[model samples]
Target chain A: NGTLVVAEHTNEKLVPITLNTITAASKLGEVTCLVAGSQCAKVAEEISKVQGVKKILLADNEVYKGFLPESLTPLLVAAQNQFKFTHILAGATAMGKSLIPRVAAKLDVSPVSDIIGINDTDTFVRTIYAGNAIQTVKSKDSVKLITVRGTAFEAAQVEGGSGATEQAPTVDVKNELSEFVSQELTKSDRPELTSARTVVSGGRGMKNGDNFKLLYDLADKMNAAVGASRAAVDAGFVPNDMQVGQTGKIVAPDLYIAVGISGAIQHLAGMKDSKVIVAINKDPEAPIFQVADYGLVADLFKAVPEMTDAMNK
Target chain B: MNPFDEIAVEEAVRMKEKKLATEIVAISCGPQQCQETLRTALAMGVDRAIHVLVDPKDYEGLQPIHVSKIIANAAKEEKADIVLLGKQAIDDDCNQTGQMTAALLDWPQATFASKVEKTNGDLQVIREIDGGLETIKVKVPAVLTADLRLNEPRYATLPNIMKAKKKPLASKKPSDYGVDMTPRQEIVSVEDPPVRQAGQKVENVDDLVGKLKDAGLV
Candidate 1:
């Protein structure tokens, strides 16, 4: 069996790509990475230390300056044709969600995305209903292309190992739908929301931008990233970056704090994955309380400051 | 200006620009009425249109995982350099489709595109990230999901609408593409979520805080 891992060229620190590759590879066959950029050979070599990685192929081209799906799609199509992989795996990342289907399309196959767990050789488990339901699927297709969500399995171990890095051929791109414009990421020294262990969220009940500072204070005390209910962001209490919903970031922290929030289906889609959830809202019957491990019926202004003080103490 | 922004009939009319090496085709998939969205691109001057007719109702029960497969299937047939969809459909309100589509295709997918420019054999895609914007240069043939700010979609005049009618629209069956329209995890029904009862509004911060403290919330 053959597997091609689309790896991140960024760093040695663990990312979803490395984790997905190693797990998918360990289950299927020999694992090889398609290191798709510059300054990635080192990272690829480091990934080789993962339990199952056999080799690394670097498809570095001046054309692939950024994460160019247009350029890389052709290369991946070419790689699949050359490698004859039984399965191709990538992270359920922005690139992963956007690009893998093109590869399956070029090969005249279907791509299964956002799969959370692998059951057997051909069976996989994925979450549905915004992580409320888990569905297990067994593919009838001979080859499978999929995007594995990060939390599905444990990350591949990293050690010091060297793997061969080869250049992947360039794709002759024809029509581009849109060009690379710009990207602005939320700057946080703390762990990213999805990977973080704790998260503090706010809602429209927080009222305005100034009130978000309370959530921020509690989050800072807990070293958590401030999250928002869909209403809060949609109501202009904060920017969309802080919004939590099916259309926003999906986070699965160990602890999630819901302050002044009335949970809605849209809002619950983002943070339902927290191991322990605490809801603090004036209304005891708030939807947020339904899913919360701990529910507090009180004014958030008082509860949050006291909680923050308690934590500080 | 983004070639995609304010795409009026003028851009297509002024086609003699030496800088533009290739023509642009707009691809959007959904049920029959989705062609209406192509009007803005047509008015602004898209070369053609690719429409894959799939029932919108089928999406009612399918999750983001299922929709991504459907999008990838439709995108595969277009043969366009880039794939552009709204960051989240106003109806489904699911923002993960773009990223999910990117995953299925194994391509670099950038979401929340506000501006787009072509230079040096790469597309200069301006993406709206957390704080501001980051310029990413991806070669053609990538997927870019559009934000509401990407363009002020123009209204199609009777003439433009008539002209857009002449543009090609091809329909591909999901079965032909070997994709199962039957959702892997289908929902039985939809209902409004439970709501919260009315809450007490304290007179002042002190009283409110004190009440909360007394209520054990503090």
Candidate 2:
């Protein structure tokens, strides 16, 4: 009868996608957010401020540092066994994608990933076939485990209600199989791509890695996150982490500006949900123009700078 | 084979070539046509193949949980040291089988792996996270799922394809693995996603910016 939201955080601040996941969890029932990390009391405090969360279950330990599936899965299973939660939810980010499946399997339940719409408690709407088709699916598992596509749901407001915090039941935290070595996260001052309000993306047409600076310059004018098409990433023009496509990160910003991207089906699968799409490319017949709200057929080399200057003016 | 799974098989074949391991066994659970996929793996230098045959009707009902259980059973029966899988199946795009199989077997799981190096019987895996790459170390008997950057899958050459026919390929039912191929989720309906109609073709950068400003998107 109750929902459990596994809060994703970095010990310092809560990831914004957790808010969207909370919104989805609130739809099912009262939500209890589980915040597991080393010295993550701040995250639990942050979760308590969000509206609709009924309780905050905080588990502070060292083993959960990396959020490894080996350690985190056991904790989730323990929480479910004690709480008897009807549904367990997480954002469809990397951590959730890697962890929820293990927890679902241990619980002997099937997990549905990247659900977009909730038809009911058991049914959900999701896009398949690279967003070409949308399917509404109904889960028969006793405990529904799901990963919410953050872009599909509006984030639950950070302010409003008060949820009581409680210590989660302790589980065996000894993990010997896996050890966290290190991480090389891109340090960016720009807003994260998935959560940004405006995104400016490039493609293989950018020609080379240095050419991405043009898109970045435009993005700087609008305070937008810079992204790239899979083609751009495959061409070594940018890191794959910046890729926006069916296989990459999905983003639904308020405004999505495509420069030189041809709008492959996979690329559209990621950003087609944006509210305002503007395409700037020399090829008038590129598939990107078909889905764009504003199409500008021009050389991006000149058009991007002009657009940046116009915005500056 | 799914594109990512092809990368997994290719990585395994590369490992064998480096003398990192002894044997490579390819497993697939689907309709009879899955043999074709398993054959592709064999052609890519897999030592053998196992196909858990399910009727097409029953195959559609199988979810990742069931598939993971089936794989876990086979892994146990085969006494495998490790399991490698694709990050996702492109058709269903569940992206859960590897982690779930690891859970079913109570083994360590490293997913979305971009790089894997063997060192002293332990695996150092660099995985693709949302922001960037994260490296971790896991002992043998772990599960690793290959990401797009893992490796380029080799094509099944004509000679290898002919030789793959002679490789050992065994078929078993889901029942043989004690897995229930039950539909945990029912597809209510499937329809085309909402289409975006092409809007105004702007004359220049200013026109486009003006339109966005009017819409309060700027």
Candidate 3:
């Protein structure tokens, strides 16, 4: 019944959206937070405070800087030998997403991703076809690795848990095939939609690019990411990166703000993952409202500006 | 490729220039039965294909990390400009392989590309974001994993199907590329999703709304 949780460490920029660790910890036994970095003891100290963690194994190494799966996978495989954990869990972010599969590779088991619910410790349920349908799978293997969809669990929950830290021997990383290159991060301070804790999204009813300024202001006030229903993007109210729908991106922010979005099946498929959805539409019965935790039957133009202006006060 | 295809639409959406591959070699990792997907890709548009075969006995519980390693190895060996994959395979529904493969190659990866184009030493990929689209331009020598919207993969016409037989289908094993096929984690079981309680078909939208609101949907 031993479980291991892998953590994403660094600049503290994207730390809050990493629910995959906590989510995985929630479903497994004796969750161990995995860390690989210099000052990793500090990272482990911070992550062990997240609720539900049982242990922290810190493998602080300078070579573990950015991330190369070939190098890191061996370390995780070695952890498996030591912990004999039945489950290995991670967030579905750039790092967690990259690392879990390698753990699976080292273990030779299927890694289930983006699960909506974990049924028992061995069985999990997730959405496929972009949340259109739910598929439940149970792992026959003893050592199952999972990458939690980023939005399912709350992050602030990690602020007060405890973990016992352990040290392991360094793993010999071969396949130093690709040299590390500098990364160019997008400069905007807005939260990334994928891991956003709160999001304000718009659709075609938003009208135009300029109108989106209202959404931006509201999102800005909320300190949230700006996402768009495909309709809003197609209508040119916003850029494509703001898109949230079946073919767009999958988001599960804690509080989802939907304005002027009519909730096309495709659009619903995207933001449906949000924890608490709020819908604002003139129509009393947009399909979006059906999925919303709160529905405001009113025009967004009148509602949004006032909402932002109020938040401004 | 058809102008309305998934990748084509992606290219158009991104506002990037497009070109044919220097030579498109489709890479696939699967059970022996998965060879059909390769034939399908060849019939669709790829110049040739490579099949990294898994031992028939060991194919079950085959993970994407292994597949990504095998494919990335092949792609690296070929010095591929772009490595293309369906966002998630239809069978396992694990979507991490393509992006993880990019990580292994230490190459920039663009996922959910609706369109792909290469021009002027820069590659343009249109990713379908939430409400709108964003066309990102990265320099050439990156990996792009495709979604269903990228291109409507062509069905192998009779002639192409016949020609696919002549096209090279290189077969390699997991060991050839140093992939450990052992399952570190195993599935305890798998079953169907939870069942929705059967409901009476409401006679009207009003009834539907009433029922929905009662369920806390409204």
Candidate 4:
């Protein structure tokens, strides 16, 4: 049985998530990457070099320009028909999050989402209840559809044996029920939150949006990505994209700095995997201290600036 | 019901108020307790409620596929023009039902909708994507899943609650729609996450910075 790894690529390049998905797919069986987008021949060429990939299914079309699930699902189903793949895998990114469920429903199967570990072909481990509980699930379905959490797996190397690329069978794309309008993205020069090496996060204790500038200043000094607890995002102190918690982005950076966060369990779930955690808050009993490698019970307003100054020196 | 679902209902009510919709029908599939959730939606200005009844034990581990099938049946039976749901249930965090339902129905879906507006018979949905916001336009009779920033739900006042008691609420079993409720996945085990050991506290910024330097993190 072979596995089909659904590849995610912006029109320009393949997203980092595809590499992680490829790594997960390698664990199951022979990896066949499915790259579907307009002007994606170069992307398919790049995927052909991933370490575990044995083949690439290229579907280039103008209709699949946007990462629209409506246009992508039929392509996947058609690909599945041609390949008869036993397992289908994708990264738990936004596009995957939206697309996989629809694909599974169309195939009349259930999907095991955000999987952290692949114990075997049938059994997998995943977090539930906002990471408070872990569940090991076994699928009874013949075709296993899975969305892997990228942070839990290492990325596949780019240099390896060349895989053969083939044209994927095309499906009709004229039945689109929705039209894409516009997008507003946060253009940042910093590293992406999920793949950043160091992350500095603030919480509701930041007081207001203006106070978040302090976090940005510190992040710039350390070359770290800026993050926020759900409380901070909910309070409108920061945009939802910066949120680092159960409902937002999950990250496992080399170093994680939590400032003024009270350490809600949801927030901890997203970053508890960081290599080293440092907590800075006024409250001595904040829950974040429990997980921190180093804890400081000081007013963040003073400590953050002092810490930034010390790091600069 | 989840807070995001409440926001979906609130959006429906706002659409009704603007004369974009004539009536609102809220539906849910769960145990007997779900009837109360549907009643709450009626109290919040929905016209009617449909309870796709199932025993709690029978539906305990049912996956999103089964749930979407039941909802698609309900929507077909009601001839629903649009289906609105929470992007994900806070309990399971599956975030699959709305998209799956749309696919099963062969209709369009716009998930993670932070803002919803009805203009000239089309739904303009601003979605919360991975790194930013994306807006899409879908013809009416589409599926839209509500996100956190959609809108704050209004409280059901005492008078509205009294009025809701007189509204129509219909309950039907999943078998009535020829939907199978068996789970596709089996739970091998559920366990607590590994606990992190408590760490040592430092006196001040200097002590904190010193520990950082010791760890070679600076």
- Which number leads on TM-score? 2
Q: By lDDT, who's the top model here? A: 2
Compute DockQ for each candidate against the true complex.
0.15, 0.84, 0.18, 0.81
- Give me the TM-scores of chain B across the candidates: 0.68, 0.96, 0.83, 0.95
Candidate 4 C-alpha lDDT tens digits along A1-313: 5999999988667899889888998889999999998888999999988899999999988888777898899999998888889899999877888999999999998998999999999999999988989999999998999999999999999997599999998788764587778888889988889988999999988999999888888888888999999899889898888989887888999999999999999899899989999999998889999999889898999989988899888
lDDT of 1 by residue, B62-144 (tens): 44455566667666765545666666544434356666676566555666766666677666777655334567766555666
Q: Judging by DockQ, tell me the better candidate of 3 and 4.
A: 4
Top-down lDDT ranking: 2, 4, 3, 1
Clashing pairs in 2: none
Residue A35 accuracy (lDDT) in model 3: 77
Q: Residue B211 in model 1: shift from native, Å?
A: 21
Error of 1 at B130 (Å): 7.9
Q: Residue A56: error of model 2 in Å?
A: 0.5
Give the range of the ten consecutive residues with the poorest summed lDDT in model 1 chain B.
B1-10
Q: What lDDT is obtained when candidate 4 is compared to the true structure?
A: 0.89
TM-score of 1: 0.68
Q: Return the DockQ of model 2.
A: 0.84
Q: Candidate 4 iRMS, in Å?
A: 1.0
Sliding window of 10 residues with minimal summed lDDT for model 2 chain A: A212-221
True contacts kept of each: 0.17, 0.87, 0.17, 0.84
Interface RMSD of 3: 7.9
User: Looking at model 1, what is the TM-score of chain A?
Assistant: 0.89
